[model samples]
Every structure is written in structure tokens, then in C-alpha cells.
Target: MSGTTWAAIDLHHHVVPREYAKALSKLGVTEGLGVQLPKWEASKALDVMDAHGIARSVVSISAPGVYFPAKDPTSAVAKQLSRAMNEACAALVRDHPGRFGVFATLPVPDVDAALEELRYAFDELH
Candidate 1:
């Protein structure tokens, strides 16, 4: 490997935007995948990043993602969740300067919504 040093980049960092967390709580998703959702805040995340010497973190919604009520075939809720999540992440990046980046959530399995989000994310959110 080329010996080089650059500030660390955390590629798979998860960010629970405030509204998203509230939405999840309302949905009764206290825990899943054998783990309760931990509290997260921008200040707390920055602290963790500093402790780990991470110069930047690319944030996105983690597992279980924006989808909800597995029975819904229309994926209507997922689209809304993805939009809010992406907007929040974009706001963080805009406000925090160099501390964070975004992966841009998409309402997946929904081709039309995903395409719209992809276009909006790159063209507008960035």
C-alpha cells in the first residue's frame, strides 16, 4: 500500500435525523435486529468522529431504512421517509462544513421514486 496519511473517512456511518427518529418511535420500532436504536445527535456524532480521528463521515439511514409496515405494496411511506431523511442529511452537510457528507436515501424497490430522488439529490441537494 502507498504510505499516505489523510484524515479518516467513515463510509458507512448511520445518521438518525430527528424527525425520522420520531417517526420510527411512533411506528413502535423500539428495537430490531436484536438491538435497540441508540440515541444520535450531531454533537454526539462529531464527538465520536473526533475520538476516532475521522475527518469526515458519509451518512445515510441504516438497516430497516425508510421502508415501513412490510405489508404496504405501494411503498408510499418509504418515499416520504426517504425524502425527509435526505433533506435532513443535506441540511447537516450544509450547516457543518467539512464534518459530514451524505449518501442520499432513495425509496428503493420503487423505481419511479428512486429515479426522482436520485435526480433531486444530485441536482438539488448537493
Candidate 2:
């Protein structure tokens, strides 16, 4: 090892943008099913990296990140929310290059929709 001191990459981080926050911020937000986020200040995330000597992070979406109010969890609305969340995440990483990476979200219980989202995230978004 060259003994270079750089911040380690944290592969798991969440930023509940308006898209993910919207569902969680519903009329009756509660525990268990409620949307939750750490004190997701970007500065704070970076601060941890600085304190821990980590230079980068590869972020991922945790479970129950975003929910759909529709009857079917595999509804188009869910897909839309997923897409929006992905977009926002991409933007965040783009805005802060060399510091963050994306861990995309897909409206699960919907395979086709997830595939489409993958295409969009990798292809169109790229």
C-alpha cells in the first residue's frame, strides 16, 4: 500500500429527496411503514468521511425507501416515484463529483418497470 490517506467509500447512504419524502410525508406518517432518513445533510455525510478518513462513497437505497399509495404496489405511480427518486439521486452525485456515487431505486414488485428504469438510469440518463 502507498499509505495514501483518503476517505474510505461508504457504499450505503440515503438522501430522501422530495420524491421519496413525499410518500413518507403522507397524511399519516407512522413508524414501521413511515419514511425515515438519517440527518442526511451532504455536509454531514462528508464530515463523517473526513472524520473516518474516507474519500468517497457509493450510495444505495435502503428498503422501504419509497411507497405508493395505490392499491397495487406495482402501479405506474410507484414507477414514477422510483424514477423521480433516481433522477434526484443522479443529480446529487453529479453535483458533487468525486464525493458521491449512485445506488438507484426501482419500484419493486414490478420487474418490467424496474427494467425500464434500469434502461433509463444507465442509457438515457447516461
Taking all chains together, each candidate's TM-score versus the true structure is: 0.89, 0.78
Clashing pairs in 1: none
lDDT of 1 by residue, 56-81 (tens): 99998766677775644688878888
RMSD of each: 2.3, 2.8
lDDT of 2 by residue, 1-126 (tens): 598755466777656554555565562443233444433567777777878878788776554555554544447666877788788778878887888888777767677888898899898666
Candidate 1, residue 48: lDDT: 91
Name the 10 consecutive residues with the lowest summed lDDT in model 2. 27-36
TM-score of 2: 0.78
What TM value does model 1 have? 0.89
Off by over 4 Å in 1: 1-5, 69-71
